[model samples]
Target: MLYQPDTYKIEQDLSRFGRTGNDTFIPGATEEGLRQYRRLLRNNINNTMVQAFPISRQVLPDDEWNELINLFFANHDAKTTQIWKLPAEFVTFVKEKDYATLWGKPWLNDLLYFEWIEIEVYTMPDIEAEPFTLQGDIRNGTIVVNLEYRLIPLRYPVHLYAVEEAKNHPGDYFMMVYRHPETREVLFADLSALDTFTFENIAHEQLSLSDIAAGLKLQFALSDQHPLLINMIAFVQEMMAQKLFLGYAVERKEQF
Candidate 1:
């Protein structure tokens, strides 16, 4: 399109310039002006990627990070008009590129996703908490995890800023991230393997504290006085204070 002499092909020229390097000369546009234009585009994209994946930026070397950004800008086709969501597009690009094999940074994408989720949570629309009343006692009612929260079962503890700490831990790292309705603050909660199990399988509108404890003992051989149980209770109290509890149902639903 740049080689085409038709002045009417403005969109075509611009599109070509956006994808590859510019190969056209506008009537009055200086070469320096064109160079700055490309530079601005790259800088804008790089800035957003940095914003989207701050931790990833810190871990990756300059050459590799710049290459990844350039690769996405040149090849990845963005389907959305929302430029703020480009890093999300980069996630898709990484998966498609087989980033684990190609770049050998399997944990990098996990970190990117972790950081991206924080951005997503911050940008989520505000929701009013439904009117809720405790069923006589705060710890006895059904425990309902808020819909605004994300139960991310990650392979690495990307929440850890220290890369060595993230690297040493191996398996599924369970985390609960929620945005408070009133304060609009994004909060992080860690879930132990037992807590993760209970949240994944046992906690519901039908379950009470006793019910959860019973299920935990039956399934995981955890006794009533287990440290995990004690810690889990404390975690729930914290979550309630943070409004991630979403209050609770007054009457536990019939299991039959």
Candidate 2:
């Protein structure tokens, strides 16, 4: 077999690019090779643009389009003054900086992450907690929330845009994303219905499902015919099958 210098050089360039741990294009790389590498890099970046920048749907002029792509995927070097090796640059940036805001409006990064969480919650081999109906004297004034649940705060609220009533408006909002032991999917609940005091009450385990229903009497009903009740039952069964629900809510008096 003939030794191919071209193939050898390509591999050498790749190895140099990979092992160097720097964003500068592999040294000794020719302009022609660099152009081919950059073309491929740009193609990959274009595919990522939709999720990264939904706003890119608008047609852009060639120069601006190229500039945004470069800013996202390329790293500049002051010495040789070349921009290349986007994968390395992207990885470095993701690790070193909060680069998520480039995708859209300021808070969209957390929205995207929250959206991704549902997929992640659905697919994991471990079973997720399902919604369950409260039993044994879940009455008016009972405050209900998951005992082991976590708020999972972002720097800003990402769920505000999701509220149908707030469709025309934009502001900060926190979400109570939870998975009861029996449910296969995560649930997203807006925390804005409750006052800051109520939110604090839930965190302190001072509220019960019964109490929450009374507080928002019209929003949710406690009857067995309620949609939430049916969903909770089915979810509880699923969680039991998966061993995901432990059925722990704060005991009313114990909450105080």
Best candidate (score: lDDT):
1
Q: Over the stretch 164-207, how does candidate 1's per-residue lDDT look in tens digits?
A: 57767768788788787777788888787866766654344445
* Best of the candidates, TM-score: 1
Clashes of each: 0, 17
Q: List the candidates' TM-scores in order.
A: 0.79, 0.40
Model 2 worst lDDT run, 10 consecutive residues: 78-87
**Worst window of 10 by summed lDDT in candidate 1:** 200-209
Candidate 1: stretches off by over 4 Å: 1-10, 22-30, 138-140, 201-206, 216-232, 250-256
Q: Return the TM-score for candidate 1, rounded to 2 decimals.
A: 0.79
Candidate 1: lDDT over CA atoms?
0.72
